[model samples]
Target: MCVEKTPWEQVIDFHGHTCPEIALGYRVAQIAMRELGIKPTPSAELKVTAQTHSCALDAFQVLNHATYGRGALIVEEQGQHNYMFEYTGTTVRVFITINPEILDHLVIPKDLSSRREVQNATLEAIQFLLSSEESMFCSIQKE
Candidate 1:
């Protein structure tokens, strides 16, 4: 008799004032998982605790080329929290709790030109990751 191992559910939680940023984070994680060849449990809801510096650093490193100089500085602290993940059966759910301090760190530049540049760069990185063949196997669900 052969016993089957249950699939693992992957979950990511992003907590931030900027909805777009949180959504982008979700997309990035989904893509990463796809690249790694891991299948997320169909309906497992995972409670992702907080977003740590390591996670931010990882994103910065990967998106540095795309963000140019804008990516170098931590314009927004985004707070210090964990990403909680929980798996039950075939479903996966993610939760991201944002630290209030993160809002205080948002720096509004004087010029829109610089802001646009950074935005464009970030968009490029997101596009590149989403379009890559490696992102085909990952599934991202926001909570």
Candidate 2:
């Protein structure tokens, strides 16, 4: 019997693995594109400039079907997980952040880079982030 893969599962497959950045990217991209009123594209309707070069960038492309090859995804490394979305030159900055304090609060281990438990951590973090009233974890700044 074959089971279906979730969107995040598909993202992990295309992305080679899963991590906190990837989870953060999935949420950030979803919110950013929704905020900008941009839909999934086979071509360039939305251009994403990322502040960091990580698996996070791949999530945007995988989830929204945006990519640099088609001129849809443009990555500008700033050594951070900040993202800027542009459509017709109108830009919105969406940054994914987790309060360092929250780590202890959530009890997420420091060495969560292991693929075995990383995916669990990713999902747990994502769930808490979206479900919690706390909005400090993710920020959407308009510029």
Among all candidates shown, the one with the greatest TM-score:
2
Q: How well does model 1 score by local distance difference test?
A: 0.36
TM-score of 1: 0.29
- The Cα local distance difference test for each model comes to 0.36, 0.66
Give the residue spans of candidate 2 off by over 4 A: 1-5, 38-44, 89-134
Q: Best by lDDT, which number?
A: 2
> How much is 128 displaced in model 2, in angstroms?
4.6
| Weakest lDDT window of 10 consecutive positions for candidate 1 | 6-15
C-alpha TM-scores of all predictions = 0.29, 0.66
Backbone clash pairs in model 2 (N, Cα, C under 3 Å; residues 3+ apart or in different chains), count? 2
